[model samples]
Target chain A: MSNINFKNIKDRQFDAIVIGSGASGGWAAKEFAEKGLKTLVLERGRNVEHVKDYPTTNMYPYEFDHRLETTYTDKQINPIANSCYAYKEDSQHFFVKDHEHPYIQEKEFDWIRGYQVGGKSLLWARQTQRWSEYDFQGPERDGFAVDWPIRYDDIAPWYSYVERFVGISGNRDGLDTLPDGEFLPAFPLNPVEDHFRKSIQTKFKNRYIISARCAHLSKPEPIHIEQGRVQCQNRTLCQRGCPFGGYFSSNASTIPWALKTGNLTLRPHSVVHSIIYDDKAGKAIGVKVIDTESLEELDFFANVIFVNAATLNTNLILLNSKSNRFPNGLGNDNDLLGKYVAFHNYTARITAEYDGLLDYRTDGRNPAGGGYIPNFRNVRKQETDFLRGWAAGFGANRGNVQDRSGVGAELKTSLLDNSKWGNWNVHSHMMAETIPKEGNTVWLDAQKTDKWGVPLLHISIDYASDDWARRDDYYEQMTAMYEAAGFTNIKTSNDPRRPGNDIHEMGGVRMGHDVKTSLLNRWNQLHQCQNVYVTDGACMTSTGTQNPTLTYMALTARAVDHAVKSLKTGTI
Target chain B: MNGNRINRRAALRTMLYIAAGTMVLPACFRESGSKTIGLVNMTINEEQELLLAEVVETLIPSSQTPGAKELLLHLFVLKMVDDCHSPEDQRNFTEGLEGFAAMEDPATGTKFINLSPADRLRFLKQIGDQDNDKITMFYSMTKRRCIQGYMNSKNVMTDLKKYELIPGRYIADFKIG
Candidate 1:
């Protein structure tokens, strides 16, 4: 509602500018600032302070007027946003309305996005896992996608760096597919889950189940304690934002550290549209931003520009920054700027009912982070059906007394008593890796534009035959595993949901050895433009089965180091 | 001038209090023993809520621990049905309740509530097992609502389940009584 005023413009230059305040951008800002660089971080959404701004963190269900209800108005108005299970009255304020910033869905792309300071980091599932050698060496092994410029060794140290900072809690299993990492002590598995784990391990030679690797600080280290962070309160209400600062998020961790440095300037409600490329210097000098509130154009100059505006948005900005030298868009001469888009192919689910576990009960208050089965297939030897592998996250617990469905005195009695805890329920969802195909690409929609008049990202993606084949195999494997583990009345279902529905959007400006084929080199610096770097999910060369946020943080930190070193060496 | 300003401020405060009182107070202070009522506080009236409470308690009665009614699961269901559910869901629930209310035993030609506990249980079992539209609706709606409400409540979470803030050790085997 504020009026645009060009007279208020005061151009300021910085050593580096990061175009986002989410997972990667926050890390970039912290790393750059810690390295003595004056960094300017631009966030498209409103500033959200931790604890103070997390409105629903400690509230009970009954306290809310809507209690977890999704209204007909919500579904009718924002169908795309309403499709997700997370879209509820309890947390509706976190999501961006589809009407405000609509994108053309070439297919049915459920582009679940949050545009606040912390972005999707506030709403993420927090299941952290390390990418093993198999993930890094997948493309070359399968002959499907371009080989990564960097390998496991290159990213392993960085993963450790991130894990130590973010405070991941998990049990270390020396599995080849799912590697171990620097982790805080793992959350204990329940008795039923342990039974399943033992059963799976005994039945299958390589297959195993373990507790989920999560970003929750199980026990705060000295570094984390110094940052005023505490251990997890076992409050499952994380998506609302942990008021305890129990989990890793930009609002809770990196940005606060950056602020303490006093060398970082964070500007919220500023959307970076494109990077201003200097043709003669052969470098990106700065970024042109659209003031979200006032609709005014502004430029912030920097020696280095870090494009951490998620995967699709980063590519959209790159493709829109067209100049005389690079008419195809800045550093997009290879026409591979917005190509090789990949997302986790999530198509598997298993549900079952258990009997004779009546007295057993778990604290229904805590979130069921779920148990994980480390990837075993194609680890030691090759498998015929699928080249890569997938991991399964499964959980089981006693059904609540309120599970009594019928009405009347019987229903009432059934609902109240914890005596009938015999009825147990088990659920498992599989995260399968997909090959990064050139055809699975995102392009700027010439027809559609946002409120700021910038072109919208048009995503055109679908799972390949290999992905489908893997999904089918995953279904069979999961059902068999559940059955073998003594789960009764087992049922399996697959939705064949769209790519972005997983909310694990990756690839596009991928890392690769060949400059001609890839947009960025190993360091995530643009092949042609050295001063500009991308360290979001955009730099993902391959889509691994694990959640990608932790990896994004690690890569951003690594990229910051690389950028700083390059600057000193006069590489730009 | 000072007296006038003070009077105006007091008047404004009184107006605000009256407006808020009219809106919220009535819902909180309902007629104490009203049995047959439509809706109150985005849920069934206290009397109907009590009936639902009794019903849920019977379904999952406390042998070892507190039952559904004790956890006020029926109130939870009513709240969910009235406020949380979609408009279509609300319609379905009302229709389902009506159908249930209209049900009569063939032998005596009497309403379901007139039947003995055993007879009621038998009738409910038959209806529930067959997955009859009305019965299924009642069953699923009540069950899901009860569980969701009870599990999220502090009584069930803290007292019944005994939620430990930090369970440091991961024990593979624990006896289930």
Candidate 2:
């Protein structure tokens, strides 16, 4: 308490401290600041202000030095990061380079990362699907992972709350497996896609397809106008960072909203060392940080602290935080800090040509991707050998094929011709779910440390038997569906990309009912230390068959509300 | 505007042959100032650059509208190949360029640079049909870059294609007859 007398100590103290400035951390910042608490968000990377920081947002194809192509050197250097579909010349700056922060891969793992104020939120594909009761009860019903502490009913209102603010555009898809949320209008499916939907509905049993719900301002409400954003312009260049604030990002939405409250202090270039636990206080008091430029260590104190440093990083931070009472890690009682890590499987893809939709072609672009075939297998009962089911992204479009043959004036004429549209092509990629196991783990390396003296992470996660069986099932089912749709030349391929490339890695410090298996409780508060909350992907008990950002935002909002209430009642 | 179109490079090329040093080296032609500007990484000189420009001009010559050369696609090719291409592709291109002019026409027995326009076109078409290793690499790289540059240039995008920066709507069933 003697440090409280120092003038600088007051500047360093806050009502709440959030570890990261990513999707979940941004929500924590906004919610805490809006609730009249002085919030401090610590980001480990450079600050990226909203529209003004998007360097390549408005650039054309020709404006880029190589016509927006990923150069050979770029691919050679960043073999893993450049393998991502979004890692082009325009959006490459947002993605972290390969060797920028090295990690030990016991197995082949491509840890795709973005380190900045917005984090991966700026470069997200923006598919925001609400998890249903099926997802909440999966682990319990199937007897695989630990049961989720909170059910869909407990977090349904939070989903609606986050959806309204985040401006999720989706249809009220009436299904028990994939529940609907508060949404704006959905981006329409092309003719061929709609044809396939009709085909599957008439023929198959439970194959429900709808437009993938996405985080975009389709029709800006008064709240969105207040946030200073407009309707999405269908640019589909979202990885470059939307200049119009058409998409939701930490830089575009939550951070600015938190700053507008005048109670938020965003501290970039603060690499968090660990949570500082006080043995006498019997809880976490503050966080230790290493300045990115200087090697100096500093500490920031707060009454309540939120650890939302993505998923693997949140586990790393907690696993590194050591105290006299708990030397293993903060809130780690039963050695469950960095176990049961899982990621979504995005290996399989099926492409086919639909020649019937010759007269119909697509105009402009779809930022919401296309149609989403929600999890159909093992919804009501476990029909397959796998524990969980998989969702798929389906879209149909024609290419702007040119007859660029011959040399001289003939080539010139063909190159200028934009009227030649090729046959309509359809494609679908699986979002398979992998059951988390003890073998799939991430921990701090014994010897190697980063320049900041933090132990480098060593990841050892691989696909299980269920993952392989699901890939084969996806291939068999998709090929049959394509044949039924009267499509020809159906080609199915499973790209041999390793795990961690999906950017949906989750469940290390997971939330559950029992303290023996989980680190966080129902309210996302640490079991032993109630003041420290982890509401990011780290808090997920099980990975649902959907893009996990929407669930993360909902969980974060719910946890903040619980924290604020607990703070008032002196329970935290 | 017409009189001022010629830059200092053109003026220098037309007027002077400098005695830069008393001890001149054998490769003093590099100081002749005919080399194109602003390209980095790739090792290129004057004659090879002119040969690339002529190849681009031959690929998409001028007619009613601006051609590949008029749109400065040769500069784009050099820039892209220099910065964007692989080291192996760059090496192949450089090696292929050394033997480009010496490719004697089978019918006329004349060098490629000395042949008539029709004969030059036929020679390139014949060379393209054959799977000549280095020459094929050079041709493919040049053609791909030239077409990309020409199709995406401001003139083509604005006047010909009408690429909307913000297309506002996605028509699911747009008709094309």
Classified by CAPRI criteria, candidate 2 counts as medium
**Full-model lDDT for every candidate:** 0.77, 0.86
Quote the chain B TM-score of every prediction.
0.60, 0.77
TM-score of chain B of 1: 0.60
DockQ for each model: 0.19, 0.65
- Tell me the tens digit of each residue's lDDT in model 2 across A459-478: 99998888989999999999
Per-candidate fnat, comma-separated: 0.24, 0.91
Query: What TM-score, computed on C-alpha atoms, does each candidate reach?
Result: 0.84, 0.94
Give me the candidate number with maximum lDDT. Answer: 2
Give me the TM-scores for chain A across all models, comma-separated: 0.96, 0.98
For model 1, what is the alpha-carbon lDDT of residue A468? 76
